[model samples]
Target: MVVNTGLYAFNVTCAHRQITPTVNSIYGDATPPNTPADFEIKVASPSFTRRFFRPQVSFYCDQHSPFKPLPLAQAYALLEWGMNWCIATHDHTRLLVHAAVLVKNNQAIIFPAAPGSGKSTLTAYLAMSGWNLYSDEMAIIDLESGFVSPLYRPVCLKNNSIDLVKQWFPESVFTSTWKDTHKGDVAHLKASSWKQYIQCKPTEIVAVIFPKFVANSDLKIYSLDQLQAFETLSKNAFNYGVLGNLGFKMVDKIIKRAALFEIEFGELCDVQAFLSEDIIR
Candidate 1:
């Protein structure tokens, strides 16, 4: 199947009916049959099906799956992760940063952080609360324009944030929870409207905020210098080393143009207020 992820297209082939529906449910907008696939996935059920104690499924990228088979229930999450891996590894046209992007009125903010940094949780909240989600995992930076493109997919909510997001926005579309993965208890909040994604032009980044969620703490924002921001972003980018000078130029340009900050936030309302009053003008 050829799935067009708005910005990029992927070709996936999976024989399992149990898994296709799940992918379809999350990425139905992209799955239009018979086009060229950017990345091909072929997943197969374990041959040891005779031992029905725990059925498993294996995910293959270009007919090769590096990881071991996972439980049948985790097939969809595996495919999602596989697709993201294929993009990060193969696509080099854009400088990819490990960040969450949110846009409002053609201005965007990039939230770059490490694992367990509450980036995805904040992204899920911003996305559901009147902000357009560019991506939950990647900030695709265009070299020529110095603008970030929207991935326009799901906001992956892991751990407790999954239910927190559900409670905050009951009207949202979410996938079934896949438990015990590398990331604990993962679920994806489908974009509130895929319509917002279709005609997405690259939006200039206004601020690059590194967020760390601290429990029971007040919102704290710290300014980062240009050199500091450059170094920080360079470290967070997946393809920076491979892109060479082009990557450095892009990162430098972004650092020069966008305001840089590191924020430790606890309350969602406080963060939202800060964005509205200070950043999103």
Candidate 2:
């Protein structure tokens, strides 16, 4: 099947026996039919029953099954999200931290946290309000330029967050909840528009926020020093060690330009207001 993403075109073919998705670029003269001049993506597999591949830097998902038929929408969403990860890991050589990105006033703010850290919940709320959503899973940074690239993929809401976000933003667009997967009870929010993906731009890193959700604690924002922030950010990186010295320099440059903080909050509205007043404006 062929998917047109405006900026790039992708062709996905499933294998009859494999479990992983492999990509084969069909650039130049080997481009697929109706391929855009800007980018062409061709994926082939010889081992599965279903597959998905995303050519855009923001997202892609490819999977193979023996007996089960995967939903097309779900497969596309997965490929899109996965492709974002693939691009960040392959192109930038910078650390791909698990986090959510929100942009305001042309500056990008990243929330890096472990699972159950309320990152997605916070991101969903911010997206519904006014902030532009970059991603909810991967933080893509350009290694050479020290800029944050946009990954306009869906925000994966897990467990209780599904109900929490539903109650908070009742009009939000959420994919059907999938059960018993990697992250217990997972649902996705397609909050960003396709225009956001095509017009994706790299922005300066303004703030690094490590958020922790405390049900009863008052919203507290702690100032984090460069060393502490760098250490934590490195730990969250997907390819820090892989990129070596270049990665270190890139991370240092980002830290020098951005203020780092650790936030503890329970209310999304309060957090949003605080970030708007303190960080963005």
Candidate 3:
């Protein structure tokens, strides 16, 4: 299948038959059949025996398998993650930051955080609540313009957040949860339709937020200086080291242009209020 995911077209072949429905549901008819794709990928059984016994699927990009085989139930998730891996690893035209990107009023803010930091939860909330979700896992910034582009992909919800989001937004579409993955229980939330995603243009990033979720605590915001923001963003980027001098210039441009902050919050509403009342203005 040639799936046009806004940012890139993927030519995906699935040996696991069930993934096709999920792909069609999320992507719709974004691309024509026989269209060219940027990345050629597959989710298939590792061996003939594995296809029948215990049933595991492995992700392949071209001929190379970057990750080990996973349970058959996780084939869709594997395909999504593998697509992200392909872009982050191969595409050097943009600066790929490990962040959740949300845009409002033609201005963008990127939340760069580590695993288990509630980034995806926050992204899922904001995206469903009217913010244009550029990406749940990557902030793809153009090297020259320093503007962020949207990736038509689902927000990955892990562990308890999956149920939390499902309960919070009953209208949202979510994939079946894959139990006991390396990231704990995992599900993907289709926060927006392809129509909405394709309407989003590459927008200038106005802020860099490093968010940490602390249970039952009040929202606390800390302003970060350029030096601090640069250091942290550099660490969060996938191609920072590979881009070298070009990377330095792009990071410098964003740091100089964007306001920087680190936010610790117990409630998603508080974060939303801060961004709307303070940052967006």
Candidate 4:
């Protein structure tokens, strides 16, 4: 089946129906046909060559699998990760960054953080609290326009956050938790409405925030100079090296226009208050 994510499309073949509802929930009601795709992928049960007792499933992109097979129950999460890999490795038209993009009052903020930095948790909180969700993983930056497009997929949660978000937003829909993956307990918060998926225009970015989840800490906000922000963003970007000079120019432009900050917080209310009183306006 071909999945058209508005900006890019791919053809995927599944070994079983395990990934069906996940694809449906993430992409909305319309199913992509099995047409010609930008990239072809498959998720199937791994061969018993190792003769291990555990059942495993592996994802293949254009007949090539990058990582080893995972537990059978994590097929859906593997598919999502595989799709992200396909885009990161192949998609060069947009300046892909390992960042979560969210917008409010016509202004967007991009959060670039390493794993365990609370990026996705903050994204889930802001997205549920009325901010527009562009993406929870990759931020597709239009090189020419310097605007970020919406992927409108699910917000991935890991470990304790899966339950934390569930308790916070009882109405939010999420996939079954897949435990013991490389990301440690992975689940995706599905796009809440079709309107969100259809609101696909590239949004202007106003801030670049590096969020750090500091336990039992007061809200600490620090300014990031353009050079600091640029260096950090370049490290987090997926296609910067592939895009060459175009990538440099684009990142430079982005740094000039957006306010850069590093924030450390323990509570969601502190984040909400900060963004509302200071950032959003």
My TM-score estimates for the predictions, one after another, are 0.94, 0.74, 0.98, 0.94
Runs of candidate 1 exceeding 4 Å displacement? 31-35, 46-53
**Model 2: per-residue Cα lDDT over 1-281, one tens digit each:** 44443323545443222212212111111224464433233233322433444211112233422222334333433454445444444544455766788888888999999988899989988987878877787777877777776654567788899998888778766666767544577777766666555555777789999999999888999999999988988888878888888778877887899989999998888899888999985
**C-alpha RMSD between model 1 and the true structure:** 1.9
Cα lDDT, model 3, residue 75: 90
Q: CA lDDT of 43 in candidate 1?
A: 67
lDDT (Cα, tens digit) per residue for candidate 3, span 214-251: 99989999999999999999999999999999899999
Each prediction's total of clashing residue pairs, residues at least 3 apart in sequence or on different chains, is 2, 16, 0, 0
Reference-based lDDT, residue 273, model 1: 89
Residue 212 deviation, candidate 3, in Å?
0.4
Cα RMSD of all models vs. native, in order, equals 1.9, 7.5, 1.2, 2.0
Q: Can you tell me which runs of candidate 2 are displaced by over 4 Å?
A: 2-10, 14-85, 92-95
lDDT of 1: 0.85
